[model samples]
Target: MTAGLPEPAGFPDCPVCAYVLTGTARLCSDCAGRTLQPVVDPHCPVCSQAVAPGGQCGNRLCTLPLQQRGFSRVDAVAVYSGALKDKIHKLKYEGRRGWAMIFGRLLVGWMESHPERMRGVDYVVGNPTHPTRQPIQHIEAIMDAAYTEDVTHVLPLSPPGAHRLVKTTETPRSANKNLDDKRTAAAEHAAALTWTGDTSDIRDATILLVDDVLTSGSQLQHVARRLRASGAADVRGLVLARVPWSG
Candidate 1:
């Protein structure tokens, strides 16, 4: 939604290898192929940490905050690296809305592969952006493709809604900040989020939180926390890319 990026040149091609595609293309069907590599495979279901394949972490120490808060699990599509990062940047900042189709396709593929994982999803929600910024239309478009009319919802944490997720206390722009700085900003942002949804409604329903990118897992973590606090029975995160934390 940022300005001066142009309309995205009619959706974007694979940044790595230029391959024209329809709205249904998940990956470069011509050059890179249709399927995409999994992001968090062989990860601890609780903490999403890389572990032995089919391995489970029984100990509480390895549990992620979301799991401890009573959510089931978190699943991402692809690692937030390589061409994925470039595509996400284009979709988010450059107004390349066409890339959203790829993201949606990936989500649908993930859901199909792990049908049980998304079994009882009652609503599809996206990570709320600042009021000044446009809603993540990409996610909505993707969700429309993913769920159709059976499940359609958009939960905003900002204006037009009584609930306020995280508020921006500092003028520090996340994209411009270093990793540590981003983490700090995210923590501050989390503290400012206020829950205004009904505890019982959120508690028993299954909620899927969508975001464009996942870096440091701070934003999702905080949002998950607030949702759980509001009584969300299960909260899962879906992101186009998962930027690994080098630290």
Candidate 2:
């Protein structure tokens, strides 16, 4: 639980089934045998839409102009609902920092299984936390503990970089808002963001941007566009959860 103490490689037992887990095991090695599922089911690789099986939509919603600009692909480990949402809420606000280790392990496992999606990644960066928000050092610690030999965490963003992505002139707490309201607020906030970093470092770099969840994806899109503008060769997103659009 301390910052420097090593996080456990995996959860001690299956949170759902109470089955004992072995070292580094993700699922309950004995019970129902349901492995963690990736969010790749008939979803659009660009926008994460749950398209009909074998169906592809080449329309603007599916093939937004941003997709063609710089970001090449997007992938997620789980849907942003039910157990996943509970876990995220716990990690982000409820002091259950241990959950981050499990999430990080899941991310590493997914990347290993789908190496193609990880192509061109030069650095791993989590979304910057706002100045008014709690420091994400614990999340970074969890990532450090769970990081495989493949991925590397880069420098933490300063207050300026974090604030640069703020869009709405008014800073609002969104914990209680509905999805549509959150999306609207985020989009409005993103439009107000202005880059101030020396983007030269990201130029020609393939950056793997990590976030806890993907809701409307407006936030991710806004940040990815800025990265591209700064000369990043490619920007790919790895979110722990994806909230389905319920419209």
Pairs with steric clashes in candidate 1 = 80-242, 165-193, 202-232, 203-231, 203-233
Specify the poorest-scoring 10-residue window by lDDT in model 2.
Answer: 25-34
Q: Model 2 over residues 24-135: C-alpha lDDT tens digits?
A: 3233111111333346577887757567788874434346665443456667776777666776787787657666656656666556566677666776666544434553
Look at candidate 1 and tell me the lDDT of residue 102. Answer: 59
Q: Rate the local accuracy (lDDT) of all candidates.
A: 0.54, 0.56
Q: Candidate 1 — which residues are off by over 4 angstroms? A: 1-35, 47-71, 134-172, 176-184, 187-200, 245-247
Clashing pairs in 2: 167-189, 168-189
Residue 197 lDDT in candidate 2: 47
Which candidate achieves the best lDDT against the true structure?
Answer: 2
